[model samples]
Target chain A: MIDRTGLMVILSSPSGAGKSTLARRLMEWDAGLRFSVSATTRAPRPGEVDGVDYHFTSRAGFEQMVADGQMLEHAEVFGNLYGSPRGPVEQAMLAGRDTLFDVDWQGGQQIRASALGRHVVSIFVLPPSLPELERRLRGRGQDSDAVIAGRMEKSRSEISHWAEYDYVLVNDDLDETEARMRAILTAERLRRDRQSGLGGFVRALMAEEA
Target chain B: MIDRTGLMVILSSPSGAGKSTLARRLMEWDAGLRFSVSATTRAPRPGEVDGVDYHFTSRAGFEQMVADGQMLEHAEVFGNLYGSPRGPVEQAMLAGRDTLFDVDWQGGQQIRASALGRHVVSIFVLPPSLPELERRLRGRGQDSDAVIAGRMEKSRSEISHWAEYDYVLVNDDLDETEARMRAILTAERLRRDRQSGLGGFVRALMAEEA
Candidate 1:
């Protein structure tokens, strides 16, 4: 029986749908989950560490890795290149680890194309309502009216692709949303098709009959 | 804001995958869920009430309902006609209730064909191992070896159609499995696309901006 297999979970949402919050809560709840740290060309923010927050890489290094197909999926967002590295995620999976990806619908599609196994599950998070989303964005107190308006417009486009996800969650309440997210991770981990040792486990039981 | 919208959920599994157990637990846990009581031609067992356990009907009555397309779907199993009625389920939906169907793959397929909406979610349950399934079947002690063998064969056929489900749960442990099932139900209820008031909710917020 194969003992180790990896799961890649891609979580997509509009800016205020609580994707990041859910991811953080899941990591805290599940010790087996590891975040898929992307290699990015953007400069790290204060207190962000390379290989922790992100794998800070130069443009040439990023392009070389992309050319070598070391990255599972890569994209140019906001003029900066960001990509998921294949080697690390594969290593984690082989060690029976789950990886979480905080990405958009496009990135989720790329991962699905590259990894077509039972190990991948994609989820989309949505706000309870467009009005509530606007309220949440305004409550953040970080963006101007124009910035919030721009984000709202982008949210509509992002939400239009809701049907693309394996599971869709409406973030109406924080605690309840976190609980639902945890349940998906737990269920996905127990999928028989992804559990490598299942065939052997069955064989062992059937041996008694023989 | 639309206050009443109904969702139809189908839970199917190979025998010993705990579909009935999970469905029972979900009904006890969630008040919003209403089990779809199917109409059947078979006479009710001792103490079984019509309309509660089932809507007992004569063969002629069943045939008439089918001819009128009043049944959402119907099938014959063990010389008994069984079908889900369309009117009551739609009424529940209009009154803001979610209906659960403990059905086989065929019934699920028919529901998908008839009700492919944001409110519909289907899940397939799987046993963690074939050996476990065999053990569970044998442990029941009611089936002969021949009957057990027949069930095992049928299970393999059922499992082959796992890909047809939107979500798959491996029933390894009862509590975990029940929790996962509940999570799916809860999450589906909150999906923005399924929730009716979202459009008006958004409009209200946009109006405030003016």
Candidate 2:
């Protein structure tokens, strides 16, 4: 295998499309794959782990990181600050290990616009149908009726940005969507431009028996 | 699976890089995938079937087709004329079945420059090393020393065009390379812009419970 430069995999989706579930499964499938543990000012829920689930931070701390150019992308949701750190993602890329981003379209666009944008492979996940999406959100039972309504509106807005993504997968089934993500990674890794060592490798090939 | 628009797969490689082997494996994997049948002025070797292996034609006949603007791409090799017909490729695309082109860099460039170019996914296959490539070619033992020398020179010339491809895969092993090609096809089909019905689907998604 060629020592390929790692990619930044940005998985964007509207709420209830199971983006988190798919991202988690991908991490499990490849242990070396790193997750962009987002920094958030929101308090951790019952089972959440700091630095694992998210890097819990004070609002000021998050703002400081953003000001210092440490955050790859940042945004506020329900008065809580959340952002992806640039350090770990950069480290992962240099180490030839991919970093997975579970972000919305706004965050996805920001990362794609960043200096390291060329390293990114952006995929948008669409729920099978709007009714099914609403059903999945309701099945989670974590949000109230008003919250669901808000989420539905946000989803519509998010879907508008689907055209911006490099790949768009309709999440009709969990395993299939996960499989598609795996395929994208497998293929993207082989792109000529992504393999930095190709120049040296090709030169070595030419030298033999020439 | 999404009903994806068919793509034009162009696989180019230096001699002995196993391009033909991988292309054959892909055809076997998906019987629906069409192998582009090129029209050639060369006479059929004993068992070569008309319209199957190649559309064997007289030089004048091939020239007429070229003059009529029937060929998507045409080239002269050694002393024979060979060209890919446009009609079947367009028809296959409309039927939602990908057509594979095992062409050299020149042919690949022509097809990419054609009107159907946007649907093309071009891949270049490289041998693991020059020594290995020579070993594979010699193992075939089907060419004279002078012919082999000419092929080696041609291979080097072909390798120069590797940068023109969308993806470059090192053909170190057969099965692994075939698997990579399959993955590329799977991912390329999911590119958002390739699925034309996506707009209607997303609009329908918004219509639900809004």
Candidate 3:
């Protein structure tokens, strides 16, 4: 019921962690929340929509957007370019609609250091244990042993940065993690500095008996 | 579920502003939460239970507790002394249980400045409007005009201190306010510094494949 500025919820976790699943659950729980869609240089394989799954653009277009400061953050991953568009984020905040980001620690840090960084609430999610994380990764039944090992090494590097986050959660159980994330969103929305309507609300309260 | 250090959730509001009701609801919402019961010099009237409604004590005993630093904070109201005992609060935090405080701004400031200040999260509740506040006070059908006027003045003083709190919520809707409070607690619990167990959790993860 509060009229407030939207928050940028940055969720970072290593591959095989449940950050993506948790993010999906949170968005489903609150349909009003928007997921940040990154612009990618990779060609769509099949069912990926242009603006929904990603903003597919030519390499030249992606480079130009980055040069023009349109991208909040951009990077070259395995020869493909990908980055979040800054326009939608800024517009969402102005409209009091929160946007969620599923990014690694590098992207999380970049957005938090941006001009709109004050709006960011970064959370790091960890698996219950390394064995559990590997079990889940193997459960996918697609990645070979070599791929799983490389992913596990990458997870160690990512997990080392957990201390950098404002809040950290161990995703032992998906439902519990989802509940905590919802609570965090609920609390962040009520922060006094985020509620733009508070000044008028207080003014009216004072004028009531005047 | 998270295992972490307990926090001091201080809720302060003006007379007729609905803080007490909110505090009651919050305690009921989480049975594990401990209420910081105040020690009073006044006699227990009606159904008031000692050690629950209050810690009944003689004026001398209460004064001695304050002098000995046993009282977290104390105040003299209408020739009677009332204060929160520090022992139980300290014990509660060490046991990893949250403690809730229903205090005025003075008590809030005191608790926040105490040695355990880092553990406190103060929230101030604001009335929707003075007219609505006055209407509620009148609807209670107990107080006289002179009493109501005095309360309104006291409320203004209370409202003036809203800026001192970590959070300021307008109590226009009860359920919304409660939900927000729960969210704050959840997020605070996940603060990396609060969860002392996280270090061991992460260590276990690292040792999984080693």
Name the best candidate (by DockQ): 2
lDDT (Cα, 0-100) at A13 in candidate 3: 93
Regions more than 4 Å wrong, model 3: none
For B24-87, candidate 1 gives per-residue lDDT tens digits of: 8998998888999999999999999999999999999999999998887899999999999988
Pairs of residues clashing in candidate 3: none
TM-score versus the correct structure, for each prediction: 0.74, 0.96, 0.95
Q: Report the C-alpha lDDT of model 3 over B1-210, residue by residue, as the tens digit.
A: 556788998999998778888888888999979999999999999999988899999988988898899988888889898899999998999889999999999999889989999999888899878888898889899999999999898888888787788788888899988888888888888888888788777876788872
Candidate 1 overall lDDT versus native: 0.80
As a whole number from 0 to 100, the lDDT of residue A172 in candidate 2 is 93
**DockQ by candidate, in order:** 0.20, 0.75, 0.69
Worst 10 residues of 1 chain A by lDDT: A201-210
Query: Isolated chain A: TM-score per model?
Result: 0.94, 0.95, 0.97
Worst 10 residues of 3 chain A by lDDT: A201-210
Over the stretch A1-210, how does candidate 2's per-residue lDDT look in tens digits? Answer: 667778999999998898989998999999989999999999999999999989999998999999999999999998999999999898889989999999999899899999999999999999988889888999988999999988988998999999999999999989989998899998899888998888888888788884
lDDT of each: 0.80, 0.91, 0.88
What lDDT score goes with residue B78 in model 1?
Answer: 92
CAPRI level of candidate 1 = incorrect
lDDT of prediction 3: 0.88
